[model samples]
Target: MGKVTAQTRLANQLLLEAIKNPKNLPVLSLADWELLIRMGRRTRLLGRLEADLSRIGLLAEIPSRAADHLRAARNVIDHRNTLVKWEINRILWALNGTEAPIILLKGAAYVQANLPPAHGRIFADVDLLRPEERIEEIEEKLSLRGWLKMQIDPYDDRYYRVWMHEIPPLRHRERGTEIDIHHRILPRTSRLNSDPALLFEAARPLEDSRLHVLAPADMVLHALVHLFLECDPREGLRLRDLLDVHLLFQHYGQEQSFWDGLTPRAYKLGLERPLFYGLRFALRFFDTPIPQTVRSEIKNAGPRWPMLWLMDHLVALAILPGHPDYPYPWATLARHLLYLRAHWLKMPPLMLARHLLYKAYLRSRGVRGKVDLAKLDLRQQ
Candidate 1:
């Protein structure tokens, strides 16, 4: 096969976005349109991307059967509200009876916030949080209900349990859904540590029941960390996640101290880079009105500039692809290299080798791949 040019890769990304938002489709030049239309129909994935778009209100402008198929796949993954309510009840019931404080995260809390219902989102797994000590017991309980522990490699499991923040993902035999049970946010190895008890203590009751969820600030911070720090390459950062941050920030604007708290909290947790990237991108793309003090503080944290820039580009590529909205070519990757070098300088040789070995293993298992660097628009600069 011929090497895929950056232009081609970008065109593919733009086309996917166009398919999701049909209004943008017509604006594509004829050559771009041909390329997009060809690629749009080629996905082999089993999920409904169309229903997800509709659920998020992006389908109105780009209405098409193609989009509908995507939506259908999303519907397949996402449980109906009734089902979600029932599942929430099941988990809540279990937690309440056992004295385990259940802290709902992401979509579960989003739906309860009334910003949008969770039915349209593609949520194959439910994420629930409890105290760290209760994880093994909770897993045992979930096991009895036919939720099996996911059979990852033993080394991966060990790494996750020891260094990572969350347990290995669990799958339900009957429902075929997954759940990520967590006691903290960042990985233990990452040097960022938040008190799980504090998160649980700050939890408030969901609208329908006694089941509690993270406070808005905590939830936003969690989402930001997940998006930037965790670097889930497969799913990428969806527009919905950014929307959540924007909405939550707006809602909590009255709490002037919120952004102030994030600085020390992020620095203490070794999550300053992710938080900086999240806030910068949220403000830049989503028009999130970040406070001036926070912006100044981020500017002052110049050491993380390289990583933050690279992440911004990665996020833009993940979200918008090859379209005009994509960032200038090679900028992020170059900065990322600097960031990596910085880490290489500090980390002990054996520890660094171990981390690289694990990363290589993840890539070998199809977790990472070349990110189409050739498709970048290098000519613009």
Candidate 2:
């Protein structure tokens, strides 16, 4: 890993400590505040700092210019939460007309569960997990209600329908709100067999809502699975993800069975490596509460040997913020390698080869891997 700079260390220290315990933070100089806010903003976490500092009466002590950004972040977050609720209502109402189970995943799940991580989170949009049997019916229902599927090249569309875990994203006709309809957490082609029934059986519903969210243990496991799969290095997937795991641990990790249950649960789902990394980083970054037995079992569960060394260095370099003036070239390399690893692990060799060939064909024709919605002129629903 690259040498940690003063900016990176200070930012990590502040953000890490804020996650560990947000109350009674020490006052900082202007330079410190600048680095802290910038890193927080990049990770979509400035709002957490704002809310925490305000809760402890330290918000007034920061530089007014810095405070302005935090205030604005909090406002943006509040608005985002409202948008999430409206989108949730719209989705549930659309699916309410059907007999299938309506379940929220990730950010939406966190919000429905009332987990602390939901606060100050930048929700992209809602993720809905429905019965695989009902996917066509649900897609048809949403289509009739004006939710249009993304129009991509035929090859990529077939890839999603045939091998992916989720369907092509559905965007609202009037509101422009986007959602992913998922049948499982991992792609169908992945070696891991994450039975959607395991999740559906464990889902708990929100008060007076037709929607259900993952149970506490299931929620944590889903976060772990998503974290390892989505850790892109080129466009860095920030530490906000690890923070989600840590925050969820803070709330639910205290349960005596939570840590013990996570191990067997992930094993059953064929996701020991992702769970291992989640616990490892949560411990390293925030000293998250994990049982020693669980720790011992997972220590050897992650990517092994040379790959392990590579990941340790690369993950740290890529995930941590560096001094703007002295960016490390190796961090970029680490991200590229890990990004490839993520894709490689998602599918077997032959299918991956075909998938790449198809995607390459699309790119040659100017089609992006995941279609860019802005290019399609999306708007808020």
Candidate 3:
């Protein structure tokens, strides 16, 4: 664990600021400014990452044609605004001919509610929720419009179908955008069995359409559950996700009845741990006004200390990559091994082993040209 050089720290700050407001690129640290300039000139490198970024809906603000050039240049970035506008347009289009209700989740809802329109937060995909009955019809409509079923492995597809709430991923042929159309937030394997109708019934109009956004309490709960499912304890577990909870709680401080309603729902659903962690972090880091009664209620619902500690470490590892900032290398590896063991328990033993072997083969191929493993003797360690 070595101290980050002053130069690296400045570069990190500039990177954060760039994500916050890409249009202010001129104000970045000198080192970062240099790197940006150099990257702007590297046509191949810039082209590839930009294409990947645009494919993932990260450059939605920039017109697709113009985004190609800007993503390749030193031009001050305004890509996030483009992405927000583009998502809104897409949602509007999806609603045009359909009577089915749409529920916007995660980053899209947060940006609409909290951040400035042009802030440069990156979202890899948009998630939407529709009725279980409409899943087939909606998939058909989207498929007709160039959104096709993702070509994932059969085992992974079955995993989602059986254990999860949604189908496999869908990628738009034209826009190259990916969307996860979910009927429920948590996996089916979890104890939480909230009615999809409740989400629709609670819909609020965002403009002309009666689209559903989670109630503030439910939104916070959803964010926590998402992070827990991802199992990445890092700040990078989607900084925007945590920011959404923080900003929402700040804007709408809930009362006793809110806590009363949430507690029973959470306990019954077995989401107590994720909910507790979400609330704890939101209240801890941000100035969220949680009343004492509500605090006590959540505390009682939360898991015991050891589980909390594990979650805390996982979150840390997710946000901060290396040691000192997180657990030591061996400890982190052991933790991940245990996590994989649990994940494998949900699948057939042979399927799990095959998947692991395939993953190892891919990893070895990825490193083949980059490292001389014979000299390093990786197996000795």
Residue range 122-222, candidate 1, lDDT tens digits = 44456788788989998888776656676666777777798677898876555556678988875655545566666777788766546677875677678
Candidate 2 lDDT, tens digit per residue, 1-381? 335455456556766666557554456677777777777776778888887778778888777988899999999988888888888877767766687668889988777667788887778888999889999998988887778888776777888889898998988766778889999999987876778788898888788557788877788888877877777756554678888888888888778788768888888767788888888888887788788999987777777689778777877877766555456676677677777777788899988788768767876998665655556654432
Per-candidate RMSD, Å: 9.8, 3.0, 10.7
Question: Which ranges of candidate 3 are over 4 A from the true structure?
Answer: 1-78, 113-120, 191-193, 232-236, 254-265, 268-270, 285-289, 321-381
Please, what are the lDDT tens digits per residue for candidate 3 over residues 101-173? 6777776675555432113345557788888888888788777665667665565677777777888877665
Per-candidate TM equals: 0.68, 0.91, 0.65
Candidate number of the best lDDT: 2
Evaluated at residue 240, the lDDT of candidate 2 is: 82
Task: For residue 263, give model 1's deviation from the true position in Å.
Answer: 4.4
Model 1 residue 302 lDDT score: 41
The TM-score measured for candidate 1 stands at 0.68
lDDT of 3: 0.56
Q: lDDT of all the models against the reference?
A: 0.60, 0.78, 0.56
In model 2, the clashing pairs are 175-380, 175-381
| Decoy 3 TM-score against native | 0.65
